[model samples]
Target: MLQINNINKAFGTTRVLQNISLELPKGETLAVLGRSGCGKTTLLKIIAGLLPADAGEILQNDQRQNELPPQRRNAVYLYQEALLFPHLNVWENIAFGLRLRKTPENELKNRVEALLVHLGLQAEARRMPQALSGGQKQRVAFGRAIIIEPQVLLLDEPFGALDPETRSQMQDFYQKTAEQLQLSAVFVTHDLKEALRMGTRWAYLDQGQLQTYPTREAFVRDPKTGIEQEIEFWKNV
Candidate 1:
C-alpha cells in the first residue's frame, strides 16, 4: 500500500500542492484527472522522490520513503515520452534494468524474451529505438520498467504523445498487463474517458487540492469532473 499523508509543496511563493492526501492500495490503479498546471505532476514527482515535499510523509508498504532517493524508493516514474535509449535494441532496452541488478544471465534471457512476447515485440526485439513506431517504443519502455517490478509506477500522461488509435491500443495493453502483474500505479491524465477506462479508483485535482471519490459513480456524478458535461455534449450530437 502507498500512503501519502498531508503532502505539501511550493515553488517560491506559489503553492503547488496543498495538504494532498490519498491512499493507493496495492494491485490497483488510481487515475488522477486534471487540466494542465494543476499540480498533478508535482504530486507524482513528490511520491517518486524526484522533488522534496515541504511537508508530508510518503510511505510504501508501511515504510517511510520521505528521505529515500528515487532509486531506493522502489517507485518508477515514466514520462510522456518513451525515453528509450537510442543506441539499444528493443530486447537490450528491456533488459537494461535487470542487467544493472546483475540478474542471472539465463533468468534475464528468459524474462526478457517473455516480456517481448507479452509486449508483442518479439519480432522487433533486434530493432533499435528509432526503428520502432511510437507505440512499439512505448511498449519497450514499459517492459523495461516492469522488468524491475517497482512497488509503485508513477505515470505522467504516458500515452499523451501517441495518436488516438495507438493511445487506445496502449491503454488496452496496459489494462491487461496490470491485471496480469497485479501492478500498482498512479495513472495521471487529463482525458476523462481515459481516466474512466484506466482507473479502478479515481481522484481529481484542481489548484493544488485533491478530491477523491469512493466509486466511479460518485466521481461521474460530481459536476467538477465534467462527466455530466461530456455526456450532455454527446447526447446532443
Candidate 2:
C-alpha cells in the first residue's frame, strides 16, 4: 500500500498541494483527474521522490520514505511522451534496469524476452524507438518501467499523445497488463472517461485539494468531478 499522509507542497508563494491524503492499495491503480496545473503531477513527483513535500509523510507499505531519492524509492514514473533512450534498441531498453542492478545476463535476457512477448513486441526487439509507432513506443516505455519491478508505477497522461483509436487500445492494454502484472499504479489525467476506463479507484484534484472515489459510481455522481457534464455533452452527440 502507498500511504500519502497530509502531503503539502508549494512553489514560491503559490500553494500547489494542500494537505493531500490518500491510501493506494497494493495492486490497485489510482486515477487522479484535474485540470492542467492543478498539482496532479506535483503529487506524483513527490511520491516518486523527484520533489520534496513541505509537510506530511510518504510511505510504501507504511514505511517512511520522505528522504529517499528517486532511484531509491523503487517507484518508476512514466511520462506522456515515450521517453525511451535514443541510443537503445527495444531489447536493450527493457533490459537497461536489470543490467543496472547487476542481474545475471541470462536472467536479464529471459526477463526482457518474456516482457517483449507479453507486450507483443517480440518481432521488434531489435528495432530502435524511432522505428516504432506512437502506441508501440509507449508500450516499450511501459515494458521498460515494469521490467524493473517497481513498487509503484506513476503514469502522467501516458496515452494522451495517441490518436483516439490508439488511446482506446492503450487503455485496454493498460488495464490488461496491470492486472496481469499485479502492479500498483497512480495514473494522472485530465480526461474523465479515460480515468474511468483505466482505474479501479478515482480521485479529483483542484486548486490544491483532493478527494477520492473508491467506486466508479461515486466519481460519476460527485458534483465537482464534472463527469456528469461530460457525459451529457456526449449523450447528445
Q: Top model by TM-score, which number?
A: 1
The sequence of per-residue lDDT tens digits that candidate 2 reaches over residues 125-234 is: 99999999999999999999999989999999999999999999999999999998899999999998898888899999999999998689999999798989888998
Q: How accurate locally is residue 183 in candidate 2, as Cα lDDT from 0 to 100? A: 90
Which residue runs does candidate 2 get wrong by more than 4 Å? none
Superposed Cα deviation of residue 149, candidate 1 (Å): 0.8
Angstrom error at residue 119, model 1: 0.5
lDDT assessment of candidate 1 = 0.95
Candidate 1 residue-wise lDDT, 1-237, digit = tens: 999999999999999999999999989999999999999999999999999999999999899999999989979899999999998999999999999999999999999999998998999999889998999989999999999999999999999999999999999999999999999999999999999999999999999999999999999999999999999999999
- State model 2's lDDT: 0.94
Clashes of each: 0, 0
Model 2, residue 54: C-alpha shift (Å): 0.6
